[model samples]
Target: MKDTFKHKGLRQQLVNILITKGIRDEKVLNAIGKVPRHLFMDSSFLDHAYQDKAFPIAADQTISQPFTVAFQTELLQVNKTDKVLEIGTGSGYQTAVLCELGVHVYSIERQQELFRKTSNFLPKLGYRAKKLIFGDGYKGLKDEAPFDGIIVTAGAPFVPKPLLSQLKIGGRLVIPVGDAVQVMTLFIRKGAKEFEQHEFGEFRFVPLLEDKN
Candidate 1:
């Protein structure tokens, strides 16, 4: 509940690190600088919150690294008023970042514990997504299909076909695909069933879970 000058200074230092690391989207950077990342983390980790790294959160998930979040979001290329689908709404940190950019986010989290936690916690921080559902990320929100962009916050062993099908014709799907280490992949929907693929380097993420409840 406290975002003091010290927190803001640390947040700015984090933003500077992101800039040096090649994250060029001003809006994305601004979003990164705006949302109180420390607030999203447990107080025990408050000291490390602004560091350019991920930390453990509830339900055994990691709030994605600031660089990772900025990178994925930059590739997704969201716009104000755009509809975006997010998989793995773990910490709601990424969710808040997306919201800060003025997009309508519909996020799915398979871990019921996280889903419930984030569902209640996000609005308290003044970041609200269009919908926060407790469900499988593999099964994209069919009811809210054709999103302008989709971001997967966890590591997927393979690209889920449903996620591709849920994008608008020109939409982008930013996901990390692999096992132990994931290659950050971006798929841009082209024609009816066509997509353009590109791969960034590599990053580690908690596994994207399927609904077991």
Candidate 2:
């Protein structure tokens, strides 16, 4: 239940594993090392927390694998002053990572259970996002649109147009798009109606639900 010395050491090992797997961003590595992933899950799953793999949390959603979190964040290329919107807040692990980078984060969670639990749990750890909205991520945050970066933590069936539309010019939207399996996709908004797209290989994730709350 506490972030002890052993936990911190384990996290450092996880960071080392991530570095070998190609996560080069120092800030991202430090964030991954700093966040106590064990505290994010039930005590029963404590042993699995820093294993660089995803583990189930409440509401059937899994805390993303550490490598995946580092990969998506590295793609965003955001600075401390940037505003990042995170879709699928999940266990708030990713949110905590963004907070470690000192960026303003606005995260959305569709599951009512996760929304309430994470809303309370995250602040207790001192990782307060700009806002944690219990709403549809497919729609993004219109009022808080024009974000410097938007990240979808779940496997969206397809790239939602609104997520792209909400990005500021040159902003990055990192999403995993697929059905049974997902290919990590990145969209960089170059202009009003232009976006550059790139796809990484496959990864698995819980489906990104819509209007489920």
Candidate 3:
């Protein structure tokens, strides 16, 4: 529960590394710097928390690498008060980042274990999603439709149609699409029935699963 000065120093170093790696969004970098990533992982991997790497969490999910989180977040172009739907709430680290940027976040997790753990953990860290539900990410929270941005933290075989339909016009959806190797993809809703797609390079993520207990 402690965020020591040492941790703060390490996070600053990480922010510098991100800068060198081409993450120019200062808001995103500041969010990365402020979040105590060590709190998001098992204590066994605490030493690696400040590194720009991903490590295993419970329920066969991996916390996304810091650069990957920043990249997806940057693509969203999140503005303060924007309503964002996060498809996977694996570690709650990415959710905290969005919260830091002052966005209203509704995140869904398919794994009940993770959903419960994160929902309980985040508020303790003073980072809370507006809503965190145990449900299918593919469904995109239909009742909470028209998000200003949608971010899928796991790799999707294809873009979920519900997610696209749930976007407000001019909203962005950032996701990684593929089975084994994913291409970081972005979709901007330009108009009703109109979207603009862009592809960044490849990344590997745990698959975004469907139904779960």
For candidate 2, write residues 76-140 as lDDT tens digits.
Answer: 99899799999999999999999999999999999999999999999999998999999999999
- Which 10-residue span in candidate 2 carries the lowest summed lDDT? 204-213
Tens-digit per-residue lDDT, 1-213, candidate 3: 889999999999999999999999999999999999999999999999999999999999999999999999999999999999999999999999999999999999999899999999999999978999999999999998899999999999999999999999999999999999999999999999999999999999999999844
The models' CA-based lDDT, in order, is: 0.94, 0.94, 0.96
Every model's TM-score:
0.98, 0.98, 0.99
**Which tens-of-lDDT digit does each residue in 1-213 have in candidate 1?**
999999999999999999999999999999999999998899999999999989999988889899999999999999999999999999899999999999999999998899898999999988989999988999999998989999999999999999999999999999999999999999999999899999999999999887666
Indicate whether candidate 2 or candidate 3 has the larger TM-score.
3
Measured by lDDT, the strongest candidate is 3
Q: What is the lDDT of residue 200 in candidate 3?
A: 99
Instruction: Report the number of backbone clashes for model 2.
Output: 0
lDDT of 1 at 152: 96
Candidate 3 ranges with C-alpha deviation above 4 Å: none
Summing lDDT over every window of 10 consecutive residues in candidate 1, give the lowest-scoring window.
204-213
Task: List the candidate numbers ranked by TM-score, top first.
Answer: 3, 1, 2
